[model samples]
Target: MGTFQIEGGHSLQGDIRPQGAKNEALQILCAVLLTPEEVVIENIPDIRDVNKLIGILGNLGVKVKKLAAGKYSFQSDDLDLDYLESELFKQEGSSLRGSIMIVGPLLARFGKGYIPRPGGDKIGRRRLDTHFEGFIKLGADFRYNREERFYGVEAPNGLRGTYMLLDQASVTGTANIVMAAVMAKGTTTIYNAACEPYLQQLCKMLNRMGANISGIGSNLLVIEGVESLGGCNHRVLPDMIEIGSWIGLAAMTRSSITIKDVSWDDLGLIPDTFRKLGIQLERRGDDIFIPSMESYEIQSDMDGSILTISDAPWPGFTPDLLSIVLVVCTQARGSVLIHQKMFESRLFFVDKLIDMGAKIILCDPHRATVIGHDFHSQLKATTMVSPDIRAGISLLIAALSAKGTSAIHNIEQIDRGYERIDERLRAIGAKIERID
Candidate 1:
């Protein structure tokens, strides 16, 4: 239970680099299991969830070596398939949501894959039906142990590719299915697949590993099954969610922060989405420069309607940054409606911000209306407990812009996403300290 004691009302300066994408790292790391050759990956973020996945891979007998900082080589020449049935494996696999993805690679490379029901943030009901259903469609036998709360998929007769139209555009589901289909007998087509940059990165990496995949940036993906896949080198993209968080932080604290090497091209709808909130940010080469300001104004629609920001699949705003968007609107000049379509519990964190004197109305589990203070009133710092990763970072941003010092406990949630956040913040002149 780590705590962050932050002194508020100070503007930050200097440049901060965004970490490698956590989501991409999870998918790419699992792809290493598909081939027996050495797969080298760079720009891996040092975070709790990612480290946990790597540890799980090591337990399953993948050869992992840290070549240098933020770079590693993984070889899956010999895997301990028996480990998947162990109690120790069950305990480890059940703790991470990313563990669900490993099942797909294992099922494709070997005859079967078994895993305990995966766990992660208590955001909402994230079912595994999509992943398993896709496997069953590809001629795999599926079984579930309700008493043990476990899932298993086996294709002892081998997998054959087929077309699948997903129930929903679930990111992990699409990644899982693609990995399974990459080595199937025939061609596989996926419609309504998630085309987020991270997912695209996974598909492109699979292509580099000798998997035939097309439609790189579109919802429709075509995969031609190959007999075997070879290892390849890949570098994960900069985390767009962290980049958005820093943008929000700079606005809330009136800081002039430059986020370097942000991969501006891949940040679809992120920059323009923040621009709708009237935040002034400039693109200088590959860097994003957010200037210090006393206040920013939220822009209404052309027809004089209140601005409504909602999350959707790729081209739309990312659900991960919606928490930061809600927080940034707290001090804006006008009001905005935040509609979080994916997770029901994400908007629940607004009550904590309200306690800090920000005016917010929680309409329901999925919707909230925020009336900005326009910097007329500063947030009153107080002690709080972090609920999840995105909400924790949003609360930290609020604390940084508040009138007094605030304590944020259970910062491990924040650590699961952001890498060395406190140290990075310190380098940028933020008044933050960690208390163990």
Candidate 2:
């Protein structure tokens, strides 16, 4: 495990660019398995999860060529199907949540897919039922081995597209099903699909690759089966979760920072959510300028109720940003309720914040009421273990804004999502050092 030694109380200033979308890269990397042609992807974030997926792809015999920094071309023409059943695959696939996405494209192209129970941050119960159910709806045979903890999807006669109404707006599940349905025999209509920018990017990229897909930014998607897909160049949008984190960091540390090339139009409700907490930010062209804040207060509702910040499906406040918001609220002028709806265990990390002298009431596993410290009482730095990716970044932001130097252990959790976070933060005048 790695640790981050962060010295707090210093303001950060500079232009920082958000990395390519992590969620989008997970889906897009898996989509490369759909076609045998060269799919050139730009702005691929070199994070642990993404790198793990790319390594898995290379191990499965996909020709992965590095075009440049943040750019790569993948060709699946020489895929090794037998590799999927190997012990190496079983072990490696179990370590990555994105491994489940490979099942859909593999079942679509190779008529079979096998995956060990996928693993990611232990935020909550991440069910794969949606992915399996979608495959079954598309005429794929689904089987799970309880003892081995492995899932297999196979369609010997090839997949046939059909209507699917998802149980929930699951991002990965939607991406997997969409990838499978694209090459199926007929038209597939997916209702209640996740319409996040990640999915929209996937749809656009597939369209560019000759897959017929409509409904770019809505909950309903229509995909017409295509005979084959060709190569296409795709550039991922900026990471909105990271953008939200940066916004929170600036507010907490009273920094003046500009997030450049943020793909502002695709950010959805992210900026407004931070603004709800009275964050001062401006959109200059595609960049977000977060001015150094002296003191900002959380806005109460129009009816004079305590402000409540909650997560919802896309076009609503993203669940991922709720952690950043929760951390930022600890430094705001007023109190706010943070409700994390999607994950049961995400808010458990608030205990660490409470330990740091922030006034927080853990109402439940999903809700917390935070009374802002407002710099009148800054958090005292302490040691902490990173629980998950989002929570880790949240804690890091908190640490940077605290009064003393704090050490965060298990920083691998943070690295899984954010690419070289310490280096990037250091470049922007953050006093952070990575300790091995």
Candidate 3:
């Protein structure tokens, strides 16, 4: 496992740019398999999970080329279908949760898609029922091998579009079904679909590739099936979760930081959500400017109730950044309740913050109450193990704002999301070094 050694209690300066949306890149990469022509994608994040999916694509005989940094072209004119059933594919597909997305496009075009159970963060029980259910609704035969944890979808007669009301507004699930529906024989309508900016970007990209999709920014998507799709150039939006993390980092470390080209309109409720915690963030054009804050207070709810911050679907606060917000609140001037309704085990990392002298009550697996120290009592740095991608970044933020130097082990989790985060932090005058 790799480690990060960080010296805390030092403020940062200079500007940073958020990487391309990781979530968007995952969906977009999978979308490339839908067409035979060249599809160019820009602003792809250089993170582990994204790269893993790209590697899987390459292994499947897709012509992959790197035009430049954060730019690539993929042409899936010919694919090695046998690789899908090979042991190598089983291992590779099982290693990445994002790999599940490839199934939809493959099933749409190739009439069959098979994959082993995908692996990801151990935050909670994330089931694949939604994806399979959507496929079944589209007239695909779904089969599972429980002992091997393998899933397969096949439609030898070709997929026929149909209406599907998803059980949940799952981002990946929505992307998968949309990809499958595009090449189906008829119209497909999806309700309760996830309408996050990333999903919207995917929809727009598919449209550019010749799929007729409506309701770009809403939960109800109407897709008219087309026989085939051509390739088009697509650029991913800036990652909103990373932007939120940086905003929280600036507030906690009392740093003056500028995040450039953030695509503010696509960020939904992220900026305003931070403002509820009394963090002063301003929009200078497309960039976000967070000034050095000695102390920021949590805003109470109207009618004099305690403030509550929770995650919801698009236009709602994102669950991915809740970990960052939770860490930031440890140093704010007031109290807030963090209700992580999406995942049961996400808030468990608060125990490490409690170890660092932050006042937090782990109300349950789903909720926590935090009383900010308001910088009066800075955290005492200590050794910590990164639990997952979001939690690791949250812990890193807490470590950077603490009193002494701290060591974080298993930093591979952080790398799974952030792109060369140590180098980026060093550029912003942060005292961070990576150790293998």
**What TM-scores do the predictions have?**
0.99, 0.99, 0.99
- What would the per-residue lDDT of candidate 3 be over residues 292-343, giving only the tens digit for each residue? 9889999999988999999999889899999999999999988999999999
Q: Which one wins on lDDT? A: 1
The clash numbers for all candidates, in the given order, read 0, 0, 0
Clashes of 2: 0
The residue-by-residue lDDT of candidate 2 on 115-183, one tens digit each, is 999999998999999999999999999889999999999999998889889999999999999999999
Over 1-436, each residue of candidate 1 has an lDDT whose tens digit, in order, gives 8999999999899999999999999999999999999999999999999999999999999999999989999999999999999999899999899999998899899969999999988899888899999999999999999999989999999999999999999999999999999999999999999999999999999999999999989999999999999999999999999999999999999999999999999999999999999999999999999999888999999999999999999988999999999999999999999999999898888889999999999999999999999999999999999999999999999999999999999999999999999999999998999999
After superposition, candidate 3 runs with Cα above 4 Å error: none
**What residue runs in model 1 are displaced by over 4 Å at the alpha carbon?**
none
Q: What is the C-alpha RMSD of each candidate to the true structure, in Å?
A: 0.6, 0.7, 0.6
Order of candidate numbers by lDDT, starting with the best:
1, 3, 2
Error of 2 at 333 (Å): 1.0
Clashing pairs in 3: none
TM-score of 1: 0.99
Could you tell me which 10 consecutive residues in candidate 2 have the lowest summed lDDT? 267-276
Each prediction's whole-model lDDT (CA): 0.95, 0.94, 0.94
